[model samples]
Target chain A: MTSSWLNGRPCDGLPVHDRGLAYGDGLFETIRVAGGQARLLDRHLQRLSNGCRRLAIPMDTDDLRNELTRFFQVLGQGVAKLIITRGTGQRGYALPEPCQPQRLLLGSPLPAYPPQNALSGIRLFPCETRLAEQPRLAGIKHLNRLEQVLARAEWRDPVYAEGLMRDMSGRVVEGVFSNLFMVVDGELRTASLVRCGVAGVMRGEIMVRASQHGLAVVEGDISYVELLQADEVFLCNSLYGIWPVTGLAERVWPVGPLTRKLQAVVADLLSDS
Target chain B: MTSSWLNGRPCDGLPVHDRGLAYGDGLFETIRVAGGQARLLDRHLQRLSNGCRRLAIPMDTDDLRNELTRFFQVLGQGVAKLIITRGTGQRGYALPEPCQPQRLLLGSPLPAYPPQNALSGIRLFPCETRLAEQPRLAGIKHLNRLEQVLARAEWRDPVYAEGLMRDMSGRVVEGVFSNLFMVVDGELRTASLVRCGVAGVMRGEIMVRASQHGLAVVEGDISYVELLQADEVFLCNSLYGIWPVTGLAERVWPVGPLTRKLQAVVADLLSDS
Candidate 1:
C-alpha cells in the first residue's frame, strides 16, 4: 500500500494549473527509509533547502521536518518522495505575486533489485544523450529532468542496468539517476557537478566517508578514456547505496577491493540504529 | 470566469501521477482566442505535432483538432492553454509502456497589457541567466522551461517589458517567451534555434511573411554587438503579435519602418476571418 499527502493534507491529485506541471518550477527528493527511519534525511533536506534558496522557492524547513517525521512514522519501511512545487500560478513565466509552495509526499514499497547487483556488479550502457551544462540548474535535483528521461529511454535491454551520460564537451557526468565514482591510482575521483549533473546525497556521504577512511577523493572532469582506464568504477544513489560497474561497453572490471570496502561501509550505515 | 478541463472532462486537478508534473515530460501551447476562434491554431497544432514527434510522444492530431475546436467554442475570447502530458508512469525516468497521453485544456481572460507596448515599443532587459544549448530539446516547446522561469525572475522592475536570453556560448537566443528579430543593414536576422530556444509560431509566420515581402532573412548567431548595431529590433509571440524593442540596456532605437510594417502585417493576419 502507498500513502500520499499534498500540502500536509491527504490527497491523490494535484491542481492541473500547478506551475510544477506547467513549467517544471519545482524540486524533488527521493529518500530511502530503513527501520521506520529515513536515512540521511538531514542531507536530503540540506540539498533541498539549498535548491530552494538558489531557485528563490520559499521553504519552511521546520514544517517540512515535522511533516517528514510524521510521514515516515506512518510509512515504516519504504521509499519516500517529496516534491515541492511553486504551486498554482497565473498564466506566465513570472513568479506569482503570493506564491504558496505545494508539497507532495508519497510513500511506496522499496523496489526489488537482484542481490547480484550489489554482490557481483552491474553492466553499464553508455548513452548517446549528452547533458547540457547549465550551472544555474546543475547539481540541484529539480523537476527539469527531460534529459534523463530521454537518456534512460535509450535502451530496452535489462542486462544494462543504468546508462552513463556525458556533457556537451564529452566529459562523463553521471549515471541516469546515480552518481559515478572511479578509483584511479588508489585515488577516488567523481565527476564535478559544478556545471551539470545532480549532486546526489549518497554521493556526498560516500565522499565524506571515503575521506574519513584516508582515501584521497578528487572531483573533476572524467573523459570517456579516463573512465575506461580507471582501475575501479561504481554507480551509487541513496536507495541503491552502491553498485560496482563490472562492465561498460566492451571494457570490463572485476569488483575491486575499494568497491567492496565502500559497499560494506554503506551497508553498515544503512543497518545502523 | 476561468474554465479548466483535464482530458476533456471539466476538472481543476490532475492526477498526482501525471508525468507532466513529475518530470515535465510534456508539451504545451498557449493559444490566443479572438472572435470565438483560436487564432493561428493550425500553426500552434503544427508546432505541437513537431514537438511531440521530436520527443517521441504520441499524438492524435485529429483528436486534438476536435478538442481544440470544441474548447474554443466554449470561450468566446481569451487565451486557451493546451497541455499534453506523457500521462502516468512508474516512478522512474523510463517511458511508461503502452503510454496514454493526457490533454489538459484551460482558459483564462486576456491579460491587460499597456496599449503603448505594441503602438510605440517596449524596453528589454538583458538577463544574466544564459540558456543551455540542447539541440535535441531546442526549437520544440517542451514543458521543461525552468530557464525561462529563472530568466523572467531576474528582474522585478516593470520598466523592462521583456528579458532577452543568450545561450551558454554568448549568442543572443530569444526573449523569455518570444522570438527576437533584428534588422541589420536591411537584412533580417534571428538566432538559430538549432542549439536552444523555442521556435515561436509567430516567429515562423513572420519569417514566411518577411520572405514574401522580399526581405533577406538569416537564421544564425546574433552577438550582443550585432544587436546594439541593428537598425530595428522586435519580439513576437502568437499572443502578443509583435512589439518593437525601443530600448535594450542603454542602447535606444526609434520605431523603424520595418517594425511598423511587420506590426501592420501581423495585425492584418489576426483580423482575417
Candidate 2:
C-alpha cells in the first residue's frame, strides 16, 4: 500500500475520476526486485516509454524514474509496479483534452517463485478466451486486460500455474501472464506478437540471450504443430523470470538446456536487483 | 467536480488505491440530471445491478439508493456517475476471496449537446477497430473499456459527434459513446448487443415507444448493407438524449419523423429530471 509520486509531493492515491479506472485506459509494468533494486529498470522504462508513444500518452521518464526509485528505495525488495493512466475524464468516451497523466509507483512483497519453477517449469491449458487481434495494441502492456483476467479465471486449482491463450485466428498466442518461447530445430523462437501478444520484458531479455549465444531467433505465426514438435518450450515474464513448459494439454516435454541457460541469466538479473 | 455521499459525513475524495484504478475492473453509469433530479435513475440502477451480478460484485440496493439521493441533492443540475469496483486485489490477476466492492459516486456538469445536432445530424466514420465478442461482458457497461478508448481516439473533430464501430464479424455494433438505431419499413430497430455494444437505457425507451406505436422493433445482427438502406438512422444515450445521424460516409438522411418523435419523448424525460 506504499506509494511514490511524480508530482514531487507525497501522493497517496489516484484522482477519483481517473480514466484508468473509468475505462481501463492505461498501461503498466511489473519488474522483479532483488537486492533492493528492480532488475533492468531501464529496459522496463524503455517499454513503458514505447507504450506511451503507441498510446500517445505523454512520457516523463525522469519523473517516473525518480518516483520509482523512491518507492523501491523504501521497500528495498520485491516487485516494483509502474502504472501510467490518462488521469480523469468525463462520462463520454472521448479522450479528455489537456489530460494530466496519473503516475504511480507501488512496491510490494514479491510472490516467491519456487526455485524449481524456473528450471523445472509448469503445465498450461489453452484457454477458451481469445486475444483479439489489434496490431496497434500488440506487444504493449496496456491496461485493457480483461482478456487476460478472464483467461486466468478459467482455472482455480493451484496445480495449474498459467493458461495459454489463442488469437482470434486460433493461433497459439502467449501464456495469460507471460511470453511463450520454444526451441525448434535447435533455434530459439517465440510467437510473433504482430497480431496480438504482449512484447514482454523477459521475452526481450531471452531474445538478447539467444543472440548472445549465437542462436538465431525468429518470430512469426507459430502453429500448434510447430509448438508440439519443438525441442523444448518455455514461458517467461519480468516477474516470474523464465519457466520451462513441462506439459501443455496432451503433450509433455522435458526441461531443456536452452531454457535452463536463459533462466540462469534471468535468475541472476532478478537476484542482483 | 461536485459530489455527494450516502452517509452524509463528507464527500471530499475516494482512496487512491481503490480497486477500480488498480484493475480497471469496475462498472459505471452516467445519468442525466436536470432541475436537481436524476433522469432514468431506476434504469441506470438496474444496469448497475445487472453488471454487478455478471461480475459477481456485491450489490446493496437500499444503500445505493440513499447514496444516489444524497448525490443528486448536492448537484442542482449535472450528471451523476456511480462506479462500483470489486475491491483491491494483490499484484496479480487472481480475484481475492471474500472481496468487498468499492462504490464511488460523483456528480459533475453534463455536456450540453449542440442543438444543430438534432437538425443537421452528424458525420460518421467506420472504425478499423472491432469489438471482440464476449457475451458475458457485452450489453453491460464495465470498466474494461480500452476497446472503446482506442475506437474513440481514432478521430478527433468537434464537427462530427462520434464514430461508428463494428464487431469482428463485420456487423455494425454501435457508436463509440452511444447505442445506434435506424428506421426501416417505418419500424424502429437497433443492433442486438448480446455479443458486443451496450444495451443502452435510451435504446430500451425507444424500443418501448416503437412497440406502443405498434411499430416493429427488431434486435439482431445489423450489417452495413441493411443499415445503409435504412430510412433513417440515429444514436442515443441517457446523457445526450437523441442525435440524428445526418450522414454516414457518403449516404445522407434528413431527420425522420420516428426519430424526431422518439427524440422528443426522450428529451422530455431527460429535461424532466
Candidate 3:
C-alpha cells in the first residue's frame, strides 16, 4: 500500500469525507527531487498560491514551505506530491463556509526510464481526447484530471509513452501530464495556456531557459504541419524532467541537437536540485 | 456523519490510494430513492455502465446490481451514490494493467429544496467559471467534478440557489448540478452537449416529455441573449427533479406555466420511483 500524510500527520487512511474524493475541489503539484531537494520548488509553490487565490482556497505559504522542506528532508531523493483540497464539507454543492482546507503531502519512488528511450525518444499517439477550455481552472494542476486519465487509459501498451491533447478548437494543447515544446521556423514555441492547458512548471522553466538563450518564443495554435516541420520536439513534466519525442502518430524524426541541449540543461537542474 | 455502503458491505473507510482521489478516474451516479426504490434506476445504471466502458473500467453490473439492491433495501429512502473507480494501481500517469475496479456506494441524506425556493423559483448567478469541453468526459457523471465544485464556489450566499456556467466561447451551458432548458423564440431549447455540456439524466427525461407534448426541442449553443429572451427557464437534475429560475444577471422572470407543467411530469416519475 502507498504511504500517506494528511495535514502533516501520518495516517493509514483518509478522513471520512475528504472533498478531494467527494468533489475533486483541490490543486496539486508533482515535483522531481535530486540531491534531496525539489527542483523548482519555489515556482511550484507560486503556482499553487496563484491557483488558491483564483479558486478562493486559503493558502498558508509559510506553513507550506516548512512542511514541504521537512517532507523532502526525510525523503533523501525522489518525487513529491503536494495536494491541497477544499477539504471536507457538509453534504451539498455549495462550498462549506469556513473551508477547513485539507493538505496531503505524499512521497513516491520514481520509475526508471531507460537512457535509450530518454535519448532516442518515445512514441506519442495524437489522442482524440480534446480538453475543454475553462480559463479559471486552466494553467493550474488541479485534481480534475479524469479527462487525461481516461485519455491515457485508451492504450495499454508500454510501447507508447504519452498522448498529445488538443483543445476544443483542435489546436494542440499539451501532453496528458507534460507540456509540449517544439522548435518551429528556427524558434521555440509552446501551446498557449490562455484558454485551456496547464502552465507546466517545466514549461515555464524552459521558457526562461529559451529567454536566457535569446530564443524567440511563440504562444498560439500549434498545428500538425508546424509540429512536423519543427526541427526538434520534447515533452516535459517535473517527474520525467525532459523526454525528446522521436515521433507522434505516423510522423517520425530523429532526436535533434536542440532537444539534447535542453535535456542537458534540465539534467543539470535535476543534478543540483 | 453521512451514511455509506461499499459493495454491499457494512460501514467502513476508504483506501488511502483510491484512484477516485488520485486521478478522478471514476464515474458516479446520484440515485434518488423513495420508499426502498431508486428514481430512474435503469437509466442511471445504463449511464454508469456506458461510462465504465468508455473509461475501460470493467464492472460486473449484476454483481453491482445485487449490492445496490441490498443497499437500498437497508436505507429505504435517501440518495445513494454509486462510485466506480479504476481501482488501485502503482503511481504515475500510466493506466493500471489488468485494471482493478472498485465500486463504492454511499448513502446520503436526501436534500429537499427549500419550499420557498421551489415554489417561487430560485436566483442563479452567471458564474465567471466556464466548463472546458472534453467530449470524451462530457455528459457522464464522472468524479472529475472540480469544475462544478469550483463554479458552485464562485459565490457563497445562501440567497443564490445555483450558478450558471458558460463554455470557452461564452455560450451558456448549465447550472453547476443541473441541465438548463429555456424557452427561446417561443420554442424549447437546451444547451448542446456536443461541445462541453452534460447530457444529464433529467435532461433526457425532459426531452422525452417535451416530445410527448409536441414542444420544439432544439439542442444548440445557448447564449446569454438567448437566456434573456427566453420566456421561461428551468434547471433539471435527477435529485431535485426540475427547478425554475426566477432571476438571472440583470433580468428577472416569474416561474412560467410550462415550467410548472413539465416539473409536474418529473414529480410523477419521482413519485413512481
Q: Per-residue lDDT of A1-273 in model 3, one digit per residue for the tens?
A: 134677887765556467777777788887776666788998899999998988788889999888888788777677788888888787767877788898887777766766566767988888877787777778888888877886676777777888888877788889987899898766888998977789998899988887787778888889767787778888988777788888887788788887887887777766644
TM-score of each: 0.98, 0.93, 0.92
For the record, the alpha-carbon RMSD of candidate 1 to the native fold, in angstroms, is 1.2
DockQ of the candidate models in sequence:
0.85, 0.56, 0.67
What are the per-residue Cα lDDT tens digits for candidate 2 across A58-128? Answer: 87898778777767777687777777898776657787888788877666777866777776788887788
TM-score of chain A of 2: 0.94
iRMSD in angstroms, per model: 0.8, 2.3, 1.6
Arrange candidates by TM-score, highest first: which order?
1, 2, 3
Model 1 over residues A1-273: C-alpha lDDT tens digits? Answer: 488899878897998889999999999999888777899999999999999998899999999999999898888888899999999887899999799999999888877778798899999999999999999999999999999989999999999989999999999999998999999999999999999999999999999999999999999989999999999999999988999999999999999999999998889656624
| CA lDDT, candidate 3, residue A71 | 80
Among these predictions, the greatest DockQ belongs to 1
Candidate 2 lDDT by residue in tens digits, B162-213? 8888987889899998889999888777888888788888888778876887
C-alpha lDDT of residue A167 in model 2? 82
Per-model C-alpha lDDT, please? 0.91, 0.80, 0.80
Residue A194's lDDT within candidate 3 is 76
Encode model 3's per-residue lDDT on B32-118: one tens digit a residue: 887877778888989888888878789998998888887877778878888888877878657777688877777877886787766
Please tell me the TM-score of chain A for candidate 3: 0.95
